[model samples]
Target: MQINPPGTVQEQRPDALTKYLQHRLAQRDREGNLRRLPQPTTGIDFWSNDYLGLAAGAAATGEGTALPCGATGSRLLSGNSQQALDLESFLAAHHNQEAALLFNSGYDANLGLLSVLPNRHTVVLYDEYCHASMLDGIRLSPVKQAFRFRHNSAEDLEQKLRRYAQPGTPVLIALESVYSMEGSIAPLAAITGLAARYGAAVVVDEAHATGIFGAGGTGLVQQLGLEQQVTARVHTFGKALGCHGAAITGSRLLIDYLVNFARSFIYTTALPAQAIDAIARAYRYIGEQPALVVQLHDLVSYFRQQLQERGLRGWCDSITPIQSLLTGGNAATRSLAGRLRSQGISVSAVLSPTVPLGRERLRICLHAFNTRGEIDLLLNLLSSCPNPDL
Candidate 1:
């Protein structure tokens, strides 16, 4: 075989697969919808999901600890530890569940739960605006049928349930406590009521609502007192709790089933002791400081009041920290975000296919630590723009 000289490297050219990938990326770029990892910027924090401003403190507390940096194997193997078990116990009690099982992340939790829980006899009915992880999980599941209901629409969900809820077929209803893009809270009470009537099991992904909604930051399922109705709830520590990893709260039977059959949890290494400690600390912190949630709600209210005062429209009616300004087009949304970034006010321009093509918008997340002045500045900048959408 001929080889390159020791001092020289051979030139590499794009293969067919590489060329196809390049074409796809080029198309995305041309459409102004190419996504890039955000560079670190020293700007006012207005885009992240840190609603209670807990990420930094929780992570900082975990730093310099004597805990292990890595888990050696999956929980079923050498990675299992007492700390993990204890944390799960705490989570179960805190969330008013009979049991809890930890997964590496919210995506892992959803994937492991949805993919294996529903067999060929089950049908999945999900909200149209559910998170990507939930959708992906359902896509990978072996369910005989899956259908989407309109976002937070109990009537549409009822229609689907009526159509699909048949004898001998188990129905699974999937929901999010809070939709990521629209920032709208799911009508959990209504949705759960529907599930009860249809004899369906409800699974809620409370990734965005965890650590900001209920008593002691449990979740909206608990806040609405619908814990008894929901079949399972996935709470993630990465968002409001400002830590990593996620847990699914349900019956002991559900947890046991996941332990035995969930591929994502069975195959992946468990989270490190440090991350578990961080999550523990975050829960304790939130429990001790009740003002964080109040402050966050206050900020959201103030922002909304300012929006109305400034005659700015096209905002999503989200009571949570997530607030969206509908900019309508990919280019316009990106331009608005870029303009904010230039002024040291960083926000996210959520574009399709993250959202529908015509529903592109700027996602502005409010934090407990964000001040009224910062809100004013952001609104002032928007007021200066001549976009009719605003």
Candidate 2:
């Protein structure tokens, strides 16, 4: 093969590549689809995942005490500290599971569980609207057979199972207890019953439901008393628990399998001691304050009522913290989000790719810490805006 002379560069210039990328970025900006990382600011905090306002709480404000910023090692190694173990145990007991294994984040937990646990003879049946992490995990799995059913449609799921269920093939039904974008609850009991009939195992991702549903925020499975039916339940602490990290709750054998075989768990650095401590603290806080959950439910009801009164009830069919106002196009959604931000509100514009094109909307998350006045203000702002066609 012919080769370039020593010290001679290729005809294709690096600047050309840079210019092309810049052009694409400029196009995105023109289309109102360019995403920018915003610096942390003091605003009417509504965009964050801090559902209970514990992230900004007094735990970080104690005199002469500083929280560690990060975790330095993986859980399989030196990271398997006492704090982490205690938190895992606490979660297991609280959720009524035989064991619990913590991961770096909800994403990692999903990745670890879905990717590693399912064998070649296993088939995964996931919800159509399951989170990205779960989808990614399934993609990484060796199990060649994975199918999706309509969101929360037990009948649809049953049909899919009937089509694919076979002897000696383990069927794992993967779904979320509470969908993140839609804010709708899953039919856990019905799904579990069907799974039992089909000899399938159920895996529930309780990222959104944890710390907001069930007794002491154990999760939706616990709320519905179907903990024993679910083979694996992923509980995330980032949302309502007001902390970081996630755990896969199941039988002790399942935990052992994941601990030994999950690449995402085995290859990654573990959560820090402080993060583990925070998780423990958050669980304790939730257990000690049952009234917080009551307050949150009351607030959600009030918000829904206000939405109905303002004639904006058609925006979403959610009674949960996540409420979407479908604005259709990316440009319109971005414009609406900007306008809300200008009014000192923080709502995220769920754009194309994060959601499907033409289904872009604003994702408004409610918090127990958010006042009634803030909710009213949000509704009042929405009421004034020209209604985009549903």
Highest TM-score against the true fold, candidate: 1
Local error of candidate 1 at 16, Å? Answer: 48
By summed lDDT, the worst window of 10 consecutive residues in model 2 runs over: 1-10
Tell how far residue 236 is off in model 2, in angstroms.
0.9
lDDT of each: 0.81, 0.78
Q: Which stretches of candidate 2 lie over 4 Å from their true place?
A: 1-72
Candidate 1, residue 24: Cα displacement in angstroms equals: 42
* Clash pairs detected, candidate 2: 73-270, 74-270
Which window of 10 residues has the lowest lDDT sum in candidate 1? 1-10
What TM-score, to 2 decimals, does candidate 2 have? 0.81
